[model samples]
Target: MFDCIIVGAGPAGSTAAYHLSNQGRSVLLLEKKSFPRYKPCGGGVSPAIQQWFDFDLTPVVDNKVNRVRFTWKKGDPVETELDTTEPFWMVQRDVFDNFLVEKAVEAGSELQDNSEVTAVQISNDIASVTTSKGKFDARYLIAADGASGAMANWLGFKEAKQFLGAVLEVETAVAPAERNTAKFEFGSLKNGLLWCFPKSNGYSLSAGIIRGGKGKVKDLEKQLTNYASELGINLSQSQFYNYPMNLWSSERQLHQNNALLVGETAGIADPLIAEGIRPAILSGVKAAEAIVKALAGDRNALAGYTDTINSEIGSDLVLAQRLSGLFFQFPGIAYRVGVKRPYAGKMMSRILCGELRYADITDMAMQRLKSSLIPGRG
Candidate 1:
């Protein structure tokens, strides 16, 4: 028997394993894919995430960004240069996830890659997990699998609201080669945004629509090719990859019996921006802490984990849901105007960076929007 059995060694699972092992607890991390396998993502890391890990930029970062371009169909695209020392780092997901797992192993956690967990059951304060290799038992279990996580279903968690995210990313040799900026095009489709992020060797472009319809990489191909043409560039020779966008909130109750949930299995992705890496890491840490505390004497340790996450990230998730819903509802020129406004952009940035709490904004806006009628309120 092990102290803890963690399913899916992604950001959340690795984070929890690292923290638990650091505290002298035995931890086992299971991953279905082989180590260093490619995972689909936007490949952009916020500067804030550097606080958690000792990021060796030279080894993984493709480029640094200090400028952002925002565009809309109503007018010419506007570029904003944020003259700050801080730069957003672009990294490949395979390298990033492997680095996180390596840290956990260094801290004493045991990792099992290419080990598919087929079944999970919790009884008498112990979790029995059956993987392709064999059966293992542990006092605590964490489901850190991605959006299609089977563990969530096994635990009877409700399905997330469906949202479509289709992105075709590729690196191509192109001119104007200073890869130091990211471009975002808005109002292209309903609840959709297009992205262009530069890497050290080349540039990557993506077009995506969330919650509008099923995303097909083939359909995105034309959009990306058209965008490249407008920039006087061609990506006919680049390597292409696709990843799904899962931006839904998991049910509030993430714990049942004795099993706990983390990462996408817990619905940690931000609904508005579809950002998950940072939140997944934080949730993993919190889950480990809660389990540890509960083992020491708190019988309701899993419940505490749920409360801690809700307290820390609940308001943000709420605001994200509300804002995404509002954006999708309007889907017009006015929405683009709001995004281009420097104040709105900064406020949104603050929320994403964890510098501001959504509850504070809610309290302030309640008075102004109260008369306008709010959804979900009778």
Candidate 2:
């Protein structure tokens, strides 16, 4: 029997399989889509993620971003700049994810693409996975199948909470090279953020707009047109990718029996931005490390998965959820406030990078609120 069966070959599953197999464990990776499949993402990677995985940008990066802009959804579009020593990079999901899986393969993980897993069961300390190809058994099973993870749902685990109803993403070319800044629009969409992340060849335009539990494609298109017009960017020939934004704060439980959940399966998205890739990759690696530790004599090693993930990601997500609610409450007002309030934007950035913790954020927010409340303190 294989040591582990990792379902879904996204960053999480592939990372897990990579680490486990590198340790000489027999790991099986299954994916429903063929390699180089498309993924709906904002595609921005913080500098911290590079250090987290010892990632080399030369392999999969599409562009390096040194600037960011945040505009109010319904308020005046004020911009902020951070000329940091480090830069955030963008990569196409297909290239980035395929590269990661290839790394896993190089490390010895067996990958089976275009293989959709239909069922899974645990018996006698082994998992029997039934996929389109056939049946296989493994000592452990990891569900990294993403937002609509069938395995987690089938197993009755708590799924990622859908905060914003729908997300509209489009890729197109923006002519002016000077406007190559990642911009976040805050005021127009209620409780959502619209963005334009520049790529090497084009830009990825996206928005998380709540549509009363459903999304309107036409309305989203109109909004995109308006945003583009404001920026003087043409998008008549843009390619679009639409998907749901499932944020994973307040995640209930992730582990059960011999099954462990990672990535979107564990609901690890940023509630504020609906970002999940970096966290998914980080959690996947941690889950694998946890499993490795467990198999190496610490019976409680597997039990540490939840603890480790929470310790690494939970706090920031909580704050992001809070910030999401605040911004969604009144996009215009919040965006206006965020422009002069560098801390607000910095908090968002730091949270994404895992440089700040929940308690730290809570204290800072409370202090800021207290200061604002004091007469003449501002």
Candidate 3:
């Protein structure tokens, strides 16, 4: 029997396996798809993620963004250059994910690609996972199979109410002026935003919209197409991809009966921006730490996971949820009066870099809005 069985070899599962295997514990990482498989993502990673790894990620990083451009409706875009020592990094998900899984393998974890998990059962403190390849028994099971996976249902966990966000992305050549700059446009969709991120070979243009919004998916696509055409970019020749993200909720149950959930399975994406990579990696690392402590005879080790996430991750998401509600409620005012103000964009850039928490900046953002909306107000 393995010490831990990790489902899905994405960032979360691979990170957990890497840590567990490095501790000399037997780890089995199962993936439904082959290595280098495509995953729908913007692929923007905050520089703070460097704290989690000891190795350099330069080989996988497509670009280090130093500038951000924000737009509201048809108004002139406001551009801001980040003044930090290190900038945010962008990568392609397929390459980045494969690299992580390879690290897990190098750390002695057994990786089984094309091994889709069909079912899981826990009894007598042992977990039995049935996959396409075969059945495996382990002391603990980590569910990192993402939002679309069925691990939560199989484990009898109640489905948490999640804010569903959708994305449509394409890659195409960009102009010299667009290189190395990330762009965000709001007010095009109700309660949503569109983005353009620079990739290694081209630019990735995407549109994100919250579910049950003013427009449907088709409307969002039309907006993106029109926006691209306005910029003289042709998306008709590019391939289109779509995916959904499940935002985090505090009420979600993370662990039960030696089975723990991590990554999208636990709804760890940011409520405001739908950012998932950093939280997924962090949750994976925290889950591994708990598993290690539990294996050392601390039955209550897993219990601390709730508190840890609350303090480190959940707190920020909670603040994000509140800010998202306020921002989306009046995106136009938020954009014109808040985001366009001096230092406001910088604060957001700092937030994206993981240098400032949303909880800490909400008040400052409100004050900026007030000063802009009401003349002679500080």
Please report the candidate that would top lDDT against the real structure.
Answer: 3
Better of 2 and 3 by lDDT: 3
Off by over 4 Å in 1: 53-59, 83-85, 174-178, 212-218, 239-244, 249-251, 357-378
Please give the RMSD of candidate 3 to the true structure.
Answer: 2.2
Candidate 3's TM-score reads 0.94
Against the reference, the lDDT scores of all candidates come to 0.72, 0.71, 0.81
Among all windows of 10 consecutive residues in model 1, the one with the lowest summed lDDT is 363-372
| 143-253 per-residue lDDT for model 1 (tens digits) | 988877789889787766555554455566645544766777667655667677777556667665655655666667666666666665556666555555556443387
Assess candidate 2 and give its TM-score to the true structure.
Answer: 0.89
Best by TM-score: 3
Q: Higher-TM-score candidate among 1 and 2? A: 2
Global CA lDDT of candidate 3, please?
0.81
Question: Model 3 off-target regions past 4 Å?
Answer: 162-169, 211-215, 367-378
